[model samples]
Target: MAGRSFLLRVANVNPANVLTHTDRALYRSIGIFILLYGGYAIVGAASFVDASSNYTHPWWQWLVGPPVAAAVIAYDRAVVGRVAVNYEHLESADPHRLLRRRTAGLYTGRMVLALLFAIVITEPLMLARYKGEIDAYLGTVHNRELARLEQSGAIAAFQRQIDGLRAQDAADDAAVADLHRLAESKRSAATSAYNQALEDSRAAGVSRRAGCPPGGFCDALVQQSRSLNAEATRLDQEASTVRQAQEPARQSRATQFAALNEQIEAQRTSNRTTVESAAGFGARTAAMWELVQRDFWGFGFFYLGVAALLVCLDCAAVWLKLVSHGNGYERAEARDARRRELSELRRHQQELRVTEAATDVADAGLDTVVREQRLLDAAVSQATTRLLAELEEQTRTALTPTR
Candidate 1:
């Protein structure tokens, strides 16, 4: 009995208005369908949230389903509850036709809403049905997306810049090494020549000291050695200057290389993130479409079938209400509604009559008051005239007293 009452409430039917077992069963059926649709909505919403890449909180994602289900339940209850039967229509010659005509717009509107809800609820379930296939398909999609990003002009440009910087650094290093080698060769030759000149000068000093004077070949040889030493010193200074000049260039290239590498890495990370986050609703839908396109006869039929079933489930209560018109429960409900309306109308008439009677009584009292005031004014005027006449008579008698 409690369960029946709950189902009646779910069906938006008053238990007192249900007059037959068939009516009771019908309402229970409607309530069952409504509950079923609500359950389906919850499942669909949960699947939608779970499949989405945007919502990262797994625990919170499940929480989204209940509120959505509640909303759907509320809407369904309202739709079912508002479909009040017009009792007067039952009196018509063709009651069912009349009822349909009266509620056609309402039925159409509810069906349209049902269809919308069905689509919203159906797509996610369809995606879930083909979860494995869609997941695999999404893998391909992510790979393709990543590949596209990597091959994009921006990434290519970055790579080109990096390669160019590396090549320039390499060429600069090689050029600097060549310069060092050239300087070393020149310095070595100059050192060798300086040593040879010193030895020759020593030999000349030894030989000339025994046979000659002060200004001799020994002094010339010493001067040659000094010139060779100066050449070696100049070569060393030039090599140091070349190295100093190339050092700043190398450092600048290194800085540029580091910065470019960072940019390239950042771009790659962004591309990876984009590809990884592509498992969203839109992506899944697109993947589903691809599956449909690939095997239209097999997957497409199942997809449409699922959607049709859900739409039917969503519209079942409304459809039941639509068709079960002029039934015992609806007739009772209609009679109750009509009875209440007539009762209200009779009460309103009674109040209006009471108000009119009160108005008449007030008007009668006002007329009586007006008539009494008029009669009082006439009596006062008559008394004033009588008093004046008496005064006039006294005055005349006094005036005639002398006779």
Candidate 2:
């Protein structure tokens, strides 16, 4: 009730406490700005901090910070030390409970608006930064892993295949060379035999004209010439066949070489793509990481600030209630003094009891005995109790319902 009373005063302090048409419109506008910006900032900071840190997020650090600040401020404003001079002019009238409710609602709206603005401003930027960093890191890692795997075995196998094809190409070239050489030798031998046969035929014609008919030697020479010519032609054809057979092998070799080139090109392209991808990912990751860090700090500060504000407000409410109800802050101060005195009194009483065990209760009452036993130590405490008793009696009389 005391806290609520303080908040009501704050609400009344606002020039536009009542919502007229124009005031209502202005209130809406304020709400929009505060909620939007506050939510944004808060969310941004929260997300950033969450992403950036490895530690568990602080769940309630903000809770105590604000209230403690507000309480100290309230205590200062209340001025608790001089109670006698500031006791007059206190009002006893209370506003309806409905007024308290309305005040609470309005205050809540403001706090929520502040929170919303925080989220709106902070969350998106932090998130973008975080995502970029993560993506880049992953891309670089993937590329490195793939490269390692290829180096381990895949690349070597590809090179081995190319080497085998090259060896086969060489064998094909040698076979083509042997076929050309055999063809040339056969042609040269055929020409030589033909020339010899022609000479023999001329000599035989002369001999026939001069004496007996041509004999077996001439026929044998002609037959041998024909056989040599036929043998040369067959050899030439066989060599041509060998050369023709080499064509498919040569073509196959060319195809194999082209395929190897294609494979190399493909690998190069793939590596280029992967590298580019990795670069992009790295950039994004760095950006996101930075964003996350920024957001984290922002949220931490914002939450802390808001919480501090709320706590101060709560303290103000209690102080305001005391002032408004005519009790004055001195009552609380006096009450605290009383509690301290009571504690001290209890300690002295305990000591007295111990001392009495050796003596007897008939000596004096507990208070008098303690007062005598520790006069200096109990003086302030005795005065505080007297003042506190008077303050309590006054507060009770004021709060009592009228007949």
Candidate 3:
């Protein structure tokens, strides 16, 4: 697919949905990139894991990787579920049928893919973030130990003694340097003087060879050359004096350096013993906490940077899901949920209809019971009236016969 087409997929959920053919391809590409990046992170994490464990004691001192892996994975799943719902709602007419279908392999596949990102990508970055924190933590630990030794006047006293020696050593070193400079100046002057004196002597000889009268220009020239020669000799003597003066300073420097070296070696030996006497990784790690605790800004920046990268991938995955108006799984689930709802509604309606029919039958039975009760009451009343009439007629007949 063209890069533009991929960009189109990335533009929005709508475009992602519209580009049906490219969705899977883009997803695969994105997945591969995420996996590769994550792999690189894992390699770094491996190194960090070993080193951190050595310093911190419990190897799991690298705490950032696992939880982050789990969280990222959970997020990926939630995204998938949401997208599935959207697909069913928007795209599928028969969502119920789709819902019944179980694609365990598909979900499992996604989870496996997400694992590559979570463990490899996110976990390693977390380790990367902690690298400086751990190092600083370790340094602080060592410093604190050193400080404790100083406070107790163990290493500190020794160091102080050495410090004094070192100070003298420094002074001697400086003096030696001055001496060397002086010696060099003297040597240069001596060489120049020697050359000048030699040249003057030669000139004086030439004047003598020219055979000028002893009391005239030759004599004056000879006197001038001798003066030059004496000046050169004085310069040479001065140069030798400077060299002799430098020797003492050089000797002092060597003596001071030897003493300083001896003191330093003693301090080194004591340090090794004290360090061995001290506690192990725990104390060191505790010291490291000082450094690690202060690196919040650094940690935050790394976290945000890694988060941004992962979030982009997350967004892309989400966008892919949003764009797919309906995937088979989504359609199936939506259809199934709908079917279940309709089935529940129909069952409720059936129950209501049965109840209504039973009510009607009861009402009819009630009416029949009422009619029978009324007929029974009327028969009883009519029978009593007829008996009373018969009795009265008999009484009147008997009375007439008696009159």
What do the candidate models score in CA lDDT, each in turn?
A: 0.76, 0.49, 0.54
Of models 1 and 3, which has the larger lDDT? 1
Order of quality (lDDT): 1, 3, 2
lDDT of 2 by residue, 28-101 (tens): 33333333333334444454444344223566433433443343333332332222322222222222211111
Error of 2 at 152 (Å): 8.7
Residue 230, candidate 2: alpha-carbon lDDT: 69
Q: Would you estimate the TM-scores of all the predictions?
A: 0.69, 0.28, 0.35
Model 2 Cα shift for residue 210 (angstroms) = 18
Query: Which tens-of-lDDT digit does each residue in 1-403 have in candidate 3?
Result: 4654453333322333333455545545544443444444444345345444543435553455445544543454354444333223323464343433344565555656655655444544455455565555555555676667655554456566657766765765566566555655655565555454444445654333444456754555555555555555565566566557766865776676577667766766787566644433344334344443666465556565775676455445544554554654355455555666667777999999999999999999999999999999999999999999999999988888543
Superposed Cα deviation of residue 382, candidate 1 (Å): 1.1
- Measured with C-alpha atoms, the lDDT of residue 393 in candidate 1 is 96
Clashing pairs in 3: 17-323, 95-335, 95-336, 96-335, 96-336, 98-332, 98-333, 99-332, 99-333, 137-288
Task: After superposing candidate 3 on the true structure, give the runs of residues whose Cα lies further than 4 Å from its correct spot.
Answer: 1-79, 82-125, 128-133, 148-307, 310-336, 339-347, 381-403
**What shift in Å separates residue 208 of candidate 2 from its native position after superposition?**
22
Tens digits of per-residue lDDT for model 1, 1-403:
8765998899887888787888888888989998998788778777777766454537766678789878777776776666464546433444353222445777787777777766666787888788799989999888888888878857889888888888987886676666666656656665665555455555543443433234665555455556655665675677578778878887888898888889888988988887878788788889899999999887888898888888888889888877776787765566666667667877999999999999999999999999999999999999999999999999999889564
